[model samples]
Target: MWHTVVGAVGLVMGLLPHVLHHIGLLAGTAFVAGSGGTALFGALGLLASVPMLIRLYRRFGSWVAPAVGLLVFAAMFSLSAFVIGPAISGAEGDVTTPSPAPAVDHTDHPGH
Candidate 1:
């Protein structure tokens, strides 16, 4: 059973590199407005969940699988909200401080 779970994770991991590469390439090349941060974070979160998934599936039959996944995802997102919410507000606070822009030296050109 453990071997089967390990094998499945290995199979998924094998496919991950190709998929990740394509996702990154597509996002970088095509989507200038939206960065791939969400996808990257999601993939990382899913990868982290695999082992927990296997264990949950093993302990509880296929019926419980979906609920376990939902719970895990919920927990992950809750944590993300808790952590990311603060950083965002903190970043905004940082920009609130007035840092004056440096003077430009276009004096050499006789615009005056």
Candidate 2:
């Protein structure tokens, strides 16, 4: 009973960030844009969910709870990344335009 409730809560919590990001309420960080940083961020999320996973494990007394948790995370991530995000923000996602290049200085040039 408690496990089911925890799993449902976990699913909703996991989906929250995606919903926020898709709706432009959340901003992306440069660190998370890099490959290594992305991995680190994922690891951090996993670590953060450890307590919930533990509770699920204790209740189920098997690997099923943890597996379900992982699946829920993946499903939420994919649903947002592929479907909701594109629908809300378009196919380009939350891309920002690049800033203009700085003007070149001509004072130091002898020809100038």
**TM-score of every candidate relative to the true structure:** 0.38, 0.45
Give the per-residue lDDT digits (tens) of candidate 2, residues 1-112: 9788868767775675445445443244343333443455456567767887888999999989899998897677667556775687455544668999999999999987
Q: On a 0 to 1 TM-score scale, where does candidate 2 land against the true structure?
A: 0.45
Can you give the lDDT of residue 67 in candidate 1? 70
Give the TM-score (vs. native) of candidate 1. Answer: 0.38
lDDT of 1 by residue, 1-112 (tens): 9789777876775576345556676664343212254455456657667677877778886748857696878687656544674475454332366789999988798866
In angstroms, give how far residue 47 of model 2 lies from its true place: 2.5
Q: Rate the local accuracy (lDDT) of all candidates.
A: 0.61, 0.66
RMSD of each: 8.5, 9.1
The worst-scoring run of ten residues by lDDT in candidate 2 lies at 25-34
